[model samples]
Target: MRKFLALLMLLMISMNSTAGLVNAEADDPVLTSEAAVLMDTQSGAILFGKNAEVKMYPASLTKIATAIYAIETASLDEIVDVSEEIEKIDGTRVYLNPGEQVSLRKLIQGMLINSGNDASLAIAIHLDGSMDTYSKNINEFLKTNIGVEDTHFVNPHGLFDENHYTTAKDLGLILNYAMNNPDFREIFGTKQLEWDGESWDTTILSHHRMLKGEIPYEGVTGGKTGFVDQSKQTLATTADNGKLKLTAILLKSEYKRKIYEDTIKLFDYGFAAFKSSQIRKGETFTSGNLKFKASEDLLVTEPVEKGKRIVDKDGILRIQNGKGEIIQAIELKPLIGKKPEAKTETAPEPKQSGLLSVNTILGVVVLVGAAGVWMVNRKQKKSRRFRSR
Candidate 1:
């Protein structure tokens, strides 16, 4: 009878304050796409997903990586000599002649804005001297720097290959990381660019209907579109609703409109249901009659819930809500009364080296390349941070 009474008291405490955890039981959105994911760009928390981690062909959406990679590694103003090979490439083209000299930046604009397969070929050849080197260098860039694991690109233009694929969740991570690059964001969000090409003389427009304002969305900041017979349709988009920023991806949609409709629905749900909350490192809390301190800045976007902290005997802290659901968990050291250590200046900690800066992803460190892109080695964990203005 005494034990039952003790359990009841704990239940009462859980109902009253779930250790100050963000709690929201928002309605989950239904999506029609075969695979989709919606995530908080800032908090790195996934708001929703369907087959998020499942591999699927990304089609031309691969250009999102290609465009950003070139922007970071290549000298944009330098001229690249177009090869006759670019002309023979199938699919979209800006129709470069056999021996045309075009700026690297111009080719990027052509590839991204026009979805020019030929232009992508030119870029691959110019940057690394051949398709093989481009493939190796780009894969290295994505793996080492951006921290995307589930994605592997076989082609710069995302032309369908059996091995070219990525998950919607992975795409969200890549987009979020890329958005930190000002140059990449500017190009990704651009609706159109003026094209003065050897064969085509007109303003090249974005294929994304929403980004072009043909299908208006209120907070649409950036987007990429892709299609191939095998991958069907793929899209990556970013939206900000003043309070929260979101990165959403849809891949392998059977219908063209399905991807767009799913994306808009996700934005609507995310904006309406989620809000960002943060808890600083070393902030103390008591739950289950135990004391704990936050390990890092705990950031999340969720429906407001009365939070409570609960700790087990092993010093593991679980931030939960009034309903006893686990929102997030962090390891806490035993709270002991001791004199605070003397302050001393120390070198800043190196940025996290992971495939994704998933704020709560399996205890990974906070990723720190928000203002730019960084290159790191697979065997090396330190960020070689660089910002491109």
Candidate 2:
């Protein structure tokens, strides 16, 4: 009977803790794309999202993940031998003939600049020996490195495979994570390259109109485009306006023009409506009577109008917009000292002493077990921490 009562009290406490977790929702932009997300590159905060979590085809955006994984895993100077499989791969190509030799650095340039499926396949096979192995490696790579949950890439090229799919949120996360790498930023931003391949030898230009100056947009850094019968049109773009760095992912647009329009609208909204806010190192916040402090300087994205910052009892800081809608939540380190609550003195009864002892033992066992499990998991999957430069 005592154990049951104790368990009931724990459930109530857990429910109460989450009661005010969600605040008022802020107004979001209207987009024509089937799915879209606008993220702040510095803080990894989602400024805007429309069906962002919905699983959809990611077309050439898969290459962003592939390029970064390869760049970090293999030496760019290593030469890769092209196999006959390149001929079988369809869609865009750098026109590499079987038995042709190309440097890894050149393959990445061709793959990203020209959206070459053949280049992607060659890099995949060369690194992992087979497409199946490439799929497993990249999936694990994204999950472990980029911390993506809703992405599964069966091919490096993002060709139409029924099993190959990713969400706009995941793609935004991937691109933001990749942009941090200097090598990836260089290749991804290249507007044009003089191609000298086995079969084709000419200048190749970026398919992203914004990056190529065809669709003029200031601060356009890097972009990738993808399309297939099943996936429709997909676009991933990055930009910086001196004050802010932003990443936009749009998926399953019916027309090419619509995606670009959507991307521009997102940038305009992000730059105009949001700004970065910071918590200095050692800054303290209070929730009820508990206190927490920032272990390091922390950056967050919020509306330009200055959102309300609320700290929860668990030491989480939630930044909310003017309408009281949560824009971002950051974890803070709890202070070591917390004064215990004052208790009312009561006369002890001999008859109830045994029951009190049993309840105390039960509670201690449960808490110790829970804490041990949490510690083990925390040690195993420590999340990557980011700080402003």
Candidate 3:
């Protein structure tokens, strides 16, 4: 009984020690906010978050989806005439008066850069002949492509509609997807734009102080800002440090400063706390044999991007396969740019030289004649030698 009790205590101690190790690695200090999230844009790895799954108002952030839908369904150069319905929008005007004509490109800029509610209506009307149709299309697009299950769009511009709500995690994923589109990224990153005698600049400059050099952040790619009486303030930013790119989302903070501070803090924490490592690239990292149309057992090489360190020496690192099976001995190396001659190195030659040479009549006859004469001479020599013996 004494020995059994001792063994039980030892097992409990071992389990506690293992749990402590996991907790140590997973320890992320929660920031003061209604909700926030930081994620690696490439791998979708979550580094730090708070209330990320809680649904909240997205405010002008809805323009992200509006911009994506417009870019996809309409051409930039297509001309759109501002209508009376657009002129009636209640908030944030791009000063686009009814009867004013603009291109889709300018409308996108007005909607994204200026947060123009009027421009949003104009885009909606232009794209779908009515805000109702545009709203439906945007919702469908968000659900189908952006994977935002918790979001619904009542209008193209994010007004205080009861229907328009999104979680921090969903918003982060939406921004992540938006940033991949060159047009959406370019438009959202614009701090100021001048077109058609209308100039617009983002309102909360210092709140996004990194844009103005008021804060120290590397690779500060531009982002979007949103505010309302009900929603307070919200922001989404993307930053890259050459090694890894991260996207951060903050929603429903009391003040603009808080939003900016929280976003910066999230970015700093992500960069400092975690490191990204690419395990494979291109044709590499695939399991089992890969077959090509014209080739067999195609030669393969591993191309790993520079991995960012997520945990310290005191923390634990866990890697798993697609099946949730932990992969042991996983090695990561920096991915170098492709060498110009990498593809040609092992490519098959047009024809086999030795086989082609044998097919030549002159080559075959010379070899056969040489072999025939040698055999005759060797036979004659053997016969003479045998006779002498």
CA RMSD of all predictions: 28.8, 26.8, 13.7
lDDT of 1 by residue, 1-389 (tens): 99999999999998778744435455668887899998888766677789999999998888888888888898889899997777668888888887799999889888877788998888888888887788889889988987888888877898878988888887887788888888778878889988888777898888888889988998889888888899888888888878889999998888888889999989988787667777788887665677777677877555554555567877776655445656445577666668988888896988876654554563433244422234435323443333321
Ranking by TM-score: 2, 1, 3
Q: Write the per-residue lDDT of candidate 2 for residues 1-389, one digit (tens) a residue.
A: 99999999999988877764533233466789999999998799888899999999888888998999999899999999987899899989999989899999999999999999999999999999998899999999999999999999999999988899999999998999999999999999999999987679899999999999899999999999999988898999999999889999999999999999999999988988888878899999999999999999988898886578899999999988777778788999988876998889986765767889899999999999999999988866654332221
Q: CA lDDT of each candidate?
A: 0.81, 0.91, 0.72
Better of 1 and 2 by lDDT: 2
Cα lDDT of model 3 by residue, 1-389, tens digit: 99999999999999999988754432355565689988777666666678889889988888878898889878999999888886567877877777778899988888877778888888888888876787788888888987888888888888897778989888878887877889888877776665553333334222355654566667888677788888888887888887778888888889777777788777766666466553323322322232112111221111122232222222222343223322222232222355665565677767768867767977889999999999999999999999999
Show where candidate 1 strays beyond 4 Å: 1-25, 285-299, 305-389
Best-matching candidate per lDDT: 2
Evaluate residue 381 in candidate 3 and report its C-alpha lDDT on the 0 to 100 scale: 100
Error of 3 at 262 (Å): 0.8
